[model samples]
Target: MSALHFDEATHTYTENGVRVPSVTQILAPLNDLSFIKPDVLQFKRDLGTAVHKATELYDLGELDESTVSPLVQPYLDGWIRLRAELPFEILGMEERVFHPAHRYAGTYDRLVLLDGKRCIFDLKTGAMFPSYGPQTAAYKNAVEKASGKRVEGRYAIELRDDCTYRLHEMTDPEDWQVFLGCLALHRFKNKHAA
Candidate 1:
């Protein structure tokens, strides 16, 4: 499959001239009215990005702990501690996947073999929410479609700021259907918005 391109200006993913919604875009409208400030949202996004980068580097054995920024160091440390306990083989990292059947695209964090099971590992650096299940489910479907392999498990691993972590196993078929509903809503919203 060709690499999917996201047009920042249009806020859409285009693959082979077909515009497809991203996982985030599909879930954007479903966010609860917590009234989080814009700067706070941006900060969280930045922190998550940094932590993901650090995790990727660590997985590839190219991480330089000294160069990791101070703000994300704690999260990185937590991930490191957690990674030590899990003996899994990394199949792919930061892999871009497209679902032709659903016409959506997303970048999954990692595909791994954990305990002889093919699973998707999604990393989070913030509070755990029910929406995360649907998000991970969507990634699982897309990744499975792209790889022609069945994903037997899905998980969300959260790296807390206190140098601790939580591993949540998310294997709910209902969540995948929920994501499909969100995709339909997203298409309707975007189609009318244009």
Candidate 2:
């Protein structure tokens, strides 16, 4: 296992002198077109980042609930509720892992032990989409490859605006294969574009 560094200027990950595609970058081209303005998407992305940061702090036992900003409070409350419902022991959070074999890298949300089951927990502050399966599966594969730990299940935890959350278990057997296809397409496009 190797450390992966993200260069903000280039918006890409590099490990061992090799540039690798992030999981989101690999899946970006497949994102559905939105009639909604680009600003809305940007807003959601920003909000998602805030919520994820708050959740990470909370999970690490460092979050001061009263200090959470008003704009992200609802999402924080939703995460609090979901946290109560989850009985898993958190093993990892917001940790970067890279697949040396596939040459891809990503930061997985969480790795947990639930009822003696090792699972990958991906937190999403958006609507559930089919892409999440491949996205989380790719994270799972990377983590398992890097840590030598078998992940028995993969779940998408969606934080909603109403202080609630929906848990979706990704059960697709071919999701990892699909993600590999996306990675290949991403490399092909970048190579040809250059």
lDDT of 2 by residue, 7-72 (tens): 867778999778888999898766784765899989988899899999999988899988888888
Candidate 1 per-residue C-alpha lDDT over 1-194 given as tens digits, one digit per residue, 9 for 90 to 100? 66678775766788888777789888776676368888998899889989999999998999989999988999988888887888888999988788888988988899999999999999999878788889889999898888789999999998999889999999667999899899988878777995
Pairs in steric clash, model 1? none
Q: Roughly what TM-score does model 2 have, to 2 decimal places?
A: 0.94
Worst 10 residues of 2 by lDDT: 27-36
Positional deviation of 139 in candidate 1, in angstroms?
0.9
lDDT of 1 at 46: 86
Candidate 1, which segments miss by more than 4 Å at Cα? 1-3, 7-12
> Against the hidden reference, what TM-scores do the models get?
0.92, 0.94
